[model samples]
Target: MCLLFRLYFLARRMHLSWVKSALVLWRNIMIKVGIAGITGYTGEELIRCLYQHPKVKISSLYARIEKPIHFSSIAPRFNKKIDLMCEPLNAEHMGDNCDIVFLALPHTVSMEFVPFLLKKGKRVIDLSADYRIPKDSYELWYKHEHTDSENLTQAVYGLPEINREKIKGAKLLSNPGCYPTSIILGLAPISKLISQCLIEPIIDSKSGTSGAGKKAEASFLFTEVDENLRCYKANEHQHIPEIEHFLSYEAGANIKVHFSPHLLPVRRGIMSTIYLNHESFSSIENIQKMYNDFYKNEPFVRVRPLGKFPEILDVAETNYCDIGIKFARGMLIIVSVIDNLLKGASGQAVQNMNIMCGFDEKEGLF
Candidate 1:
């Protein structure tokens, strides 16, 4: 009788020990994420998305401040939810605290911290133009000397639709620019068709003022932007090379675009209308079907029905890219829309993080 009682207690103790071990393993799986430019627009958006992520904990927030301040003090919307302090920018501290670090800084700034974070064995997703293009192209376009060329060669372009597999194994991710995100996705499905039959495509893209970033610029002021639609960079936008580079890779041929970016009178979205003139014989139905097939399994890309169009409102504040196709006259028109800050910047950053960490691709996006 005593032997039976002892066996029962021993078995129960083993079961409890197993349960405790499982709990510890589960807790370790939650990733500790950090954001660098935490006071900027993209940084704030990153916080908002990461706060809702089931497998993440925002371990650190860095900004260009002299002292630590509450994160909610910088962005009031996160008042009750994220009660954390935003510390001064320190690459060493960030690397020590976070398993993954997101660089939401401006173009030239991200390059400064990326190399250090990478050395510390931390995965990095950079939301800037620093690592997107080659060194020479970056200097020619942004007028800034490329400081980090070693990592530039290895950084994976973070567009999940086209580079999902690459992103999965990426330790350094270069998030696509806002304009390139909309334009590339719009042109990706028909890349082969364009190379075979089309001439240089004409791209007319318009974006909200928020694409400019959170800065005190005279041109982006309310009086200047409100009730105004202005075309600024025509055929000379910095994103021209980036759009051509990736699209060319997709089509296996050199693809150039006459990209014209306009400033819209809104706050947060991008709409790109691409005019592709092809000499081949294909009906509008076939083209629509191709687009549907191309993005059918994609989680964030939504192809609109034939003869239907997408507006900026369709993908506003969401990580979705809504694309529409139409054949008018001798031109094949493709319209693509996305929130410049979400799919264009921070939401896509988190998506890359999810892919790198082996989490579900759409874990926190929806």
Candidate 2:
């Protein structure tokens, strides 16, 4: 009958419209993110950056407390913008709610939660020394037993400039330390030259007190650090193995570096001066050109011109690493600078997340 035909047509049209609506809904699905150790400095920075991400929604935030407290209460600037509370550590709840998780916990603590998150099929970017190196090296350097050694090989070092392809497919990302980031970015491009030219390079780096963390410590007090600059962990810094491991891979040989880290009186930023000695002098022009070519297409690395040098102000508060190169008196000195909290930790973590999630690498960073 005519009535039956009309009903059939109406149903077909409705089905087609339903299909279209479903497609649109799928396309606009936002990625839900969770942050563990939400009270830490890196976690705060992650919250700040990810809040602006177009395709992201911060679904959960976990701190080390029992009762819930509004995140805005701790960080009052985000009062109106972010309305979530910092919940207690519950890996199962985070894994159920979030598509990806950023672990800003202390070194050994991250390894404990990572296995649970991964078992629940969640991606993780750990901003700790836990998974940066192999288990043996981690135990040797950090003096802690790695509970999840099986996940070590699965973790990709989350330096976007050097490991973009690997980071894209990674489930676990080990965010580099502030010192390692500044030191590695400065040395990675010329790793081959460093291997062939120098016996040992002396890396002198200075970082602001914020690198010490937000924890209340007498050593990091205003009075203690006000007008003082001293070197700690001169040759025994934990980041030594991380820097050397990556550099050795790039150089295709064993390489050693003498590293010294100093604490500056300021708030945030790292300036690393790498002293290189070559058997024969390579022209400053060629050296600068080599660096320029190496990082020309990279979005985050900025190489200065031949006679100019980089300062902390050049890359402070941004996800950028600025390098200044020079050759003088049988030595090649490279100055690299970055904001310790941004390029060194949280911003880089977001960069890795963007890559892993198939978003633009610079998303939410600007």
Candidate 3:
């Protein structure tokens, strides 16, 4: 009887230990994601966010151009924490390295590596202009011949609010531009965008110096932009068509916006003020209620109080887009702010990754 009882007790303890180990293994399997172009500011931010995510892990970091150097040599933030070599972007290694990949390189740059990733059967969230728009638009505006034109239509535009359902299942998603991300989120809650609507939206966006990239240029020099704001890519900016395309498609009508971009002196952030034409101003109470209803569950969007506008400082370090709406002379004026490097680029990509990988959308973003 002593031997029988001892054996039964030992078996029960072994079964419980096995169950615990199984749960731990399941949890880890949900986590390991990777990043491409990890040398860039946005890529580093993705790494930073994943480092904190309970359900995600940065198992790999890739950079084709920034290779043959230590991560810290390229970007000091990853100094010792990321003591890994920057490897080239390829599908051949991703299955061994990571399950999800974020391409934070330039538009044209991402196009070259995607076919390999697809062949490797890896999911992608591209933070580049290459896959953001339609193929013809990419060809016309970017002036680059697309190597993956056939796959362009299949790449889901990864704006969560408008295309949440599709994004949840997409194997490849193209994250929106910083300007378009801010502008669309600011305008969408209140936009009817009907063809007969006489509203002409003027999206005046000003971004910090970081939007230009890490490369040094005389134009982006401190002496040049210290206290000045210069508008570039005015009415004909590339983002204009993207904004119009999303707005029009969402509202089921053609829409045109006078998009104007400006460069600011700060290091990071975007402040976009949208001016709308409406015969009668929507009451502040109604506007707030509407926006609140629309984005109530969206963890990253904040609708500011009616009397107060959002400042860049409030959203500078977050993956949030702060939107404040005001009305005057029958026009709705909106101010939307975002940390261009975070919400505009990497955070959004991670959010899309969470969706694609069947993790909670806010797993790493919030």
Candidate 4:
């Protein structure tokens, strides 16, 4: 009886040791994520998406605050879901705590903190225009001097459909803008066709008021935007150069877009209607097939059926870019739609992080 009792206790101790080891392994596998600029729409969306991610633990939240405060206090929607604190923007503290840091800041502001975070060996995904184009283009269009030329040269453009392989190994990622996301994806598959036919694509993009960010501008006021449609930048928007740069890269020749952006009264999506001269192209059936073939392997891009076009409601509140094509009256019209806050900004950032970290591309998004 004494021998049997001692053996039972030994087996119980071994089982407890194995259980502890498994728990430690599970904790180690989770990615520790941090967010800077947690007050903006993109930042808030990031918190919402990352909180639902299975492999992520949001370790830190930073903003330009005087003292640390609960994130839920600022964004009440996350009250029960995310109980983290929004601390002041401390690069060192974020670097120490997080394996990856997302900068949802504006253009000039992201450059200030990126180099320091890189030096601390933390991967960065910037959802700003800072690192998207060359230094000269940025300076010319944005009217701001490019400060971090070294990192800018190395930052990979984070469009998973086009730059997936590069994104997998990128240490610094430049997330594409909302308008560019819809426009570029609409035209990427037909890049060679545009080059071969010498076609100059004309893009008319409409976006919701939220694309302007959380600001107190008179133009973006509720009274101004309610039931009103206005075209702000015509052909000379800052995003023009960015769109041209990537499309040019894909086409292997210089590609220029006659882009005009308008403000819609609604709150969250982007629809870019792209018109191309289809004089030298194939039939409508063949064009649709081509787009289908090109994006069949892409996870988030959904190519709609022939004679059907995508609407803003089709992709609202999701990390999806729905595209439809039509050949009519010697013009090939393509429509693309995406939720501005999701696929355009924060959701795309998380997708890039998944690729970089070797997690499933659709892990957090769905």
Off by over 4 Å in 3: 1-30, 89-96, 193-196, 280-284
Q: Model 1 over residues 228-259: C-alpha lDDT tens digits?
A: 99998799999988999999989999888899
Q: Residue 346's C-alpha lDDT in candidate 4?
A: 95
The CA lDDT of each predicted structure is 0.87, 0.85, 0.78, 0.88
| TM agreement with the true structure for every prediction | 0.91, 0.91, 0.87, 0.91
Q: Report residue 1 deviation for candidate 4 (angstroms).
A: 47
Better of 2 and 3 by TM-score: 2
Q: Clashes in model 1: which pairs?
A: none
Tens-digit lDDT track for model 2 on 223-244? 9999999799999999999999
lDDT of 4 by residue, 1-47 (tens): 22332232333345566544444443237778889999999998998
Q: Which ten residues in a row have the lowest lDDT in candidate 1?
A: 1-10
Residue-level lDDT tens digits of model 3 in 1-366:
223322333433455675444344343454456778776778778788877777765667778663456667777766777677677776567535666677888768887878788776667788888887787877888788988987688999998888987886676899999999999898787667434575768889999988887667899889998999899978888887799888877777777789999999899999999987776455667877778888898878998888578999999878899999887777788899999988898888878777665467788666
